[model samples]
Target: MGEENKIILHGTWASLFSKRVELALKVKGIPYEYVEEDLSNKSPLLLKYNPIHKKVPVLVHNGKPVSESLVILEYIDETWKIGSLILPEDPHERAGVRFWANFIDQHVLLSVAKIWKSTGEEQEKAQEEVLEKMRILEEGMKSTNLEICANDLGLLQILLLTTFGSFKAYEEVLGVKVLVQENTPLLYSCVTSLNELPVVKEICPPHDKLVALLNIYRQNAFKSTTN
Candidate 1:
């Protein structure tokens, strides 16, 4: 492929959204250059590529920018059709995946953010919400029979992988266990199984490193609040 035709991912290492794009590219066996961005001082390329959000996980394919993690995943799946399909071929199944993926994005992610960024009564409420959401997700996974299959890792699994990876960081900072075996056996199994995938294992940041980062982030958040 020509240089211009090559894929270039602009993302931050600490960002779970960025990791989603990285996982998709690796799973598809797409060769790409990664440009790590410092969110404190984002690169010009990221600004130029994603002027609207100005966020990490901007995928520049053939010099065309695709922003947002879920959008980037779908773009990769459609662009590189030879790899594992991110969505099922059946329309009903695809819709179901999209629905649950949106649920995670909207509900679960917001709850996690609240838990990490709040304290006292607010944090307590967020913690309860997180557990409730996980319970719902656990039941949903059981109903759908979602597992980490080698040949069919759908978009929902990818989203869950990112969510679960971030959950470790939040769990450490918040002093909570969201994915215990007894509470969420199926979802816990899925997380463990996905973490072992070569593509996922290669891209996921170390657990300790992520926890450290979350600690710093929580401290900064607290300082800002008190000040």
Candidate 2:
């Protein structure tokens, strides 16, 4: 492919959404240039690529920009049909993958934010919500034979992997065990397996770095609450 048609990804290392796109590209073995965005002072390139949302995880392919992590994932799957497919061939299985991906974005992610941003009664409520959501997710996984989606790694797996990886930071900051081995064995197993993947191990941010960032966020949240 010509240089103009090559893929370029704009994203931040810490962003779960960005990580999802990164994982997708890595899984598909697509070679792309990675541009890390400083969210505090975003680059002009990021703005040029994603003017509306102006967010990370923008996939620029063939000089065309594709925003939104899930949208980029589907685009990658459709564009590169080699390697492991991110969506199943069957329409129903594809829908299931989409459903779980949406669930992680709409429900699981929102609850995780609440857990870390709030305190006291509000934080406790958010914790309950996260646990409830995890239960539902675990049940969904159980029904689907414990695979992330269908029989192979797909969009849902990428989404959930990033979400759960971020949850490790939140769990430490909030002092809660969201994905316990005893309570959610299958989900825990899924997390373990996903982490062990070579691509994921190489690309996913280090756990200690995530925890340090979360600690800073926790301190700031406390300071704001006190103020």
Candidate 3:
């Protein structure tokens, strides 16, 4: 909030990664300016801030740019040092949070992307990976005390919030249930808990709109695969 700590987040409305950064900033009661960027156009400022990725959810604090959503989440927690810490104080617990967050992004989201982006054998493989990863995450939650509490806002919780938030849209688009309650009750419970929170609700995109967007993206992805 101070002049020396002016924070700006560059992101797009429909970007899950962008939503992660916005959710973190809002949860911490941190004041920041939001700048929405068109990924298609790739603004020069976005390019300058994050040349390697040239992506959104770039947090610029004190004029310094921080790229990558997971990295930015921890950065937010570390820098503020007030309110409830999003990352746990215990190093081991913190490590677990980071590990699972990465797993969700890399294994879960990436595989889910392939489901809608690819077809035939590749898409079938992705669907299997999605289920397997979900099982792993459910077991991971059961092994630990991690749950999606709005007040806590831990790294894993925040990441799951963004990922699970998109499940409905993905399901509607792909005609498959990725986060099934029968198979992964613990993970399903986390999704339910996340939805109960007002912060999570506010952060979630319009469900119908998201489904339409996913369908459009799916069509485009399918087209690319064929061509």
Stretches off by above 4 angstroms in model 1 are 144-151, 224-227
lDDT of 3 at 111: 80
Model 2 agreement with the true structure over 1-227: per-residue lDDT tens digits:
57866999999888888998898888888899998889889999899989999998899998899999889989999999888988888887888778877888889778877776777788889888987888898888678653662335687777777878556676777887667677677677777777777888888787799889879978887777789
126-216: candidate 1 lDDT, tens digit per residue: 7789878988977886687665434356787788788785566667777876566777776777777877777777988887988898899
Check candidate 1 and list the clashing pairs.
Answer: none
Name the best candidate (by lDDT). Answer: 3
TM-score, cand. 3 vs. native: 0.92
Tens digits of per-residue lDDT for model 3, 1-227: 78888999999888989988888888898889999898889888999999997888899999999999888988999899776688888988788877778789878888887888866787778888899989998788668766544446777777777877678778888877788888888777777777777877887889888888888899999898789
State residue 45's C-alpha deviation in candidate 2, in Å: 1.2
Model 3 bad stretches (over 4 Å): 119-125, 148-151
**Arranged by lDDT, best first:** 3, 1, 2
lDDT of 1 at 126: 79
Candidate 2 total steric clashes:
0
Model 1 TM-score on a 0 to 1 scale: 0.92
